[model samples]
Target: MEHREAAFRKLFDLYRHDIYAYGKSILKHDEYAEEIVQDVFLKIWLNREKLDPELSFRSYIFAITRNLAINFLHKAANDARLREEVFYKSQESYNPAENNIDAAYYDRIKQQAIDILSPRRRQIFELSRNRGMSYEEISKELGISVSTVKNQMSAALETIRNFLFAHSDLTLIITFIAFGWL
Candidate 1:
């Protein structure tokens, strides 16, 4: 166990910076790049027993880093698209009163969805949306890495979106706008 731990530590030390650089180049975001580094290393450690010393360790690690970074970007892009769709829908002239629900009812539903979030996630969400703080700003204020803030915010948005979809008659766009995700 000690030997494996030492090997993993050495591997991390050797490749962490290189992986971070690769992720940064691809993502163009420092926080996400840092996350790729951590996630890649965690994956490597978990799968250490499968490590083949005969193969180029650098290549193997870089492949993992690249794949994870790509996945991260894909998810971010999809989330952005969903938000845009919701925003566009919210801007339409449809009247909520036609559906027999007032704006305040939507507000209450939004609050209920928010109330369902874990404490840290709710804080992160509020910082990003309500406080109008950037991910980097929230990270610095909360004394956490930017990646952590981004992850929490992403999770909070998804949770709220799901909650609104399942529990309310409002369209996705209306729910998103009412929840201030736009």
Candidate 2:
């Protein structure tokens, strides 16, 4: 137990900042970035007994961070969707008012926009945004070039934006919701 604790401490001391910085780069927001970093460490600490001492600790930690970030994003997306569904359901059940009809309309348009993308572009985009896979990771997993991943993602974003007239608020909200912004 003592040795295990010491090893964890040493690993944390060595790589916490690197993990945080890597998360910040991918997340592009300070709060979520910090949360991802902290969550990685917490997970590591909680599951320390299962970790292999002979394995590459840094790689293991980074993989954990990636998966945690993706999961956080997924949960956030599902929550947004649930909120939209419940909002509409509650309105229909109780008020029968149409105050926020635009929200629903925009949601549909966003879904339609996604559906209109090329299959490959759409797949790549969804994997990146929905699954929160980094371009390098996605490329490695999909056996595609990083440039190809970037191009497809960019195209997907452009297609979505064109469908929305580039309205910053809608674009941002749609992207966040689609990418599982919490």
Task: Mark the regions of model 2 whose C-alpha exceeds 4 Å error after superposition.
Answer: 80-182
Q: Which pairs clash in the backbone of model 1?
A: none
Q: Estimate each model's TM-score.
A: 0.44, 0.44
Model 1, span 1-182: residue lDDT tens: 89878977887888889999887655555676798999998898888778888999898988787668546544544586644553344446676565555566777887999999999999998888888999999999999999999889888877875575456643442435534573
Residues 1-182, candidate 2: write the lDDT tens digits: 89978987887788888888776544445676688878888898898778887998888988787666556544544687644543343234343364376558666766777898998988888788778899999899889999999988878876775554333232334345565432
For all candidates in order, the CA lDDT equals: 0.73, 0.68
Candidate 1 wrongly placed segments (more than 4 Å): 1-101, 170-182
- Tell me the lDDT of candidate 1: 0.73
User: How many Å off is the CA of 89 in candidate 1?
Assistant: 11
